[model samples]
Target: MTRFALTVEYDGRPFMGWQRQRHGPSVQQAIEEAAFAVTGEVATVHAAGRTDAGVHGLAMRAHLDVAKPFAAFRLMEALNARLRPAPVAILACNEVADDWHARFSCVGRSYEYRIINRRAPLTFERGLAWHVARPLDAEAMHVAAQRLVGLHDFTTFRSAHCQSASPVKTLDRLAVVRDGERVLVRTAARSFLHHQVRSMVGCLAQVGLGRWSADDVTAALEARDRQRLALNAPPDGLFFVAASY
Candidate 1:
């Protein structure tokens, strides 16, 4: 069998998440179904990271092993044809070394969260962004968020149900910026505990709104308590932007 790596793009609004679920459609199932359409055999596909419901992905990487190899261009064409109506497409495909696992081989992943800070509700971006009716201090949020870049015990930023072996993860980049009305938070790391990025964004928003000082992030990190942090920002604004090997 030969291992094939596929770059996928999807609109996550219409499905459950990346992982297969009993009750709803999933990104994984779509790929499996498409692989069947392409090769006449069902293949198990593993993703670099599993996203939550309502989150979108601009570029997600996954891998599947096939009994026969198809040219990369031909596989992409066939998979996209079968995966339509679910808003998923195979952006690219390439053969990789048999030992290269999509999830475990990834060196880093990046995510972006978008929030609209204004007094009125957005008509065009109903579920595409987080709508807040107050001004956000992007610069303040940027400064406060920077404190999280580096190795730290990030229990405060992890979900209660996070099953990662450890809560210690290094954040390589965290940037908060404003483009017009939306406050954008971009984060990247080698790996993350569940909800880590959203958790950090929630805490940063508190500082952005003057509810917490920048030092509050440090306190929470040192406390190592999940309850010490703020909200876990909504999933709508989050997107799996990219993955690098």
Candidate 2:
């Protein structure tokens, strides 16, 4: 079998998430179906990250093993052709070593959350971003975000259903930026607990709204209790921005 790496993009509005589910469509199942159409074989593909329902991915990476010889670029075109209208696309396909696993080889992962602070329901951004009616304090949010940029046990930000063995993670970066009425939060880590990014965003939003102080965020992190964390942000605003190998 020839091992290959695939760069994928998808609008997470239509499916049940990145992984396959018995009850609904998924990015994995979509890609797998396309792979079967092209290679006449069902091969399990692995992704760099498994996004939750209603979450999008801009540069998700995957690995595929095919027994038949096929050109990388050609495979990309064929797969996209078959996956049309499903809100999923195979961005690129390139040869890789058999030992190179997409999820395991990843060195870092980046996520971005977008929110429209002064939105009138965000008609254009429906299902794409979070819409908030009140303006946010961007300066305070940025300054407060610095407190989370280090190694810490993030149990408070983790979901109870997280499959990761531990909640300890090193937050390499957390940046808050503003673009007119839209606010974006970008974060990176070596690995993350499930729902960690959204959970952090929820807490930061409190700070932005002047409800939660920076000390409150710190206390929540130190508490290591899920109940102490802020309400989990909606998944519509979250996007898997990139994966660094």
Candidate 3:
């Protein structure tokens, strides 16, 4: 069997997230179906991250193994051709060793959350970003985000349904910046607790809106309790931006 690694980009508004579901469409199902169309053999596509519904992917890393022999480029083109109208694209593809894995081999991952801090309704980017009518202090948010950087017990930011065995994770960076009316929050880590980024963003938004202070963020992290969470931001603005092996 030959293993092929694929870099994928997709608009996640129409699917039930990255994983295949019995009830709805999924990015994995789409790519797997396309793979069968190309190789005439069943395959399973594994990703570096499993994003929630409505969470887009700018450059998600995934891999699959096939028994049939085919050039990497030919397989990529065939998959793209057959995956038409799915809003999912195979951006790059290459052969990898059989032992390589898309998820377990990944060493780093990054995500970005976009918020349009404006009152006007979205026209072209309706479901692509989080629309906040209130003005956000990106500087304040950045200051508050620093509290979340480095290693910590992030139980306060984890999801109730998270399957990870441990809540202790090291965050490399979390920065908030403003590009015109858009507020961008970018984060990097070796791994993150489920909903950790969204939960951090929601509390930072409170600080930006003057409802919470930077000290409150530190306090929350120290409390290490899920009930102390400020809010859980919607998945609309989150994007799996990059993954490194």
Which tens-of-lDDT digit does each residue in 1-245 have in candidate 2? 89989999999999889999999999999999999999998899899999999999999999999999999999899999999879898887999999999999999999999988994778888999988787789878888888888999999999999999878889999999999999999999988889999999999999999999999989999999999988999999999989988
Candidate 3 per-residue lDDT, tens place, 185-224, comes to 9999999999999999999999999999999999999999
Each model's lDDT comes to 0.91, 0.92, 0.95
Q: Candidate 1, residues 104-171: lDDT per residue as tens digits?
A: 99999999999999999988877778887888999999999989999999999999889899999999
> Candidate 3: misplaced stretches above 4 Å?
none
Q: Which is the better candidate, 1 or 2, if ranked by TM-score?
A: 2
Candidate number with the higher lDDT (2 or 3): 3
Which candidate number maximizes lDDT?
3
lDDT of 2: 0.92
lDDT comparing candidate 1 with the true structure: 0.91
- Which ten-residue region of model 2 has the weakest summed lDDT? 116-125
TM-score of each: 0.97, 0.98, 0.99
Q: Score candidate 1 by TM-score against the native.
A: 0.97
- Candidate 1 vs 3: which has more TM-score: 3
- Residue 58 error for model 1, in Å? 0.7
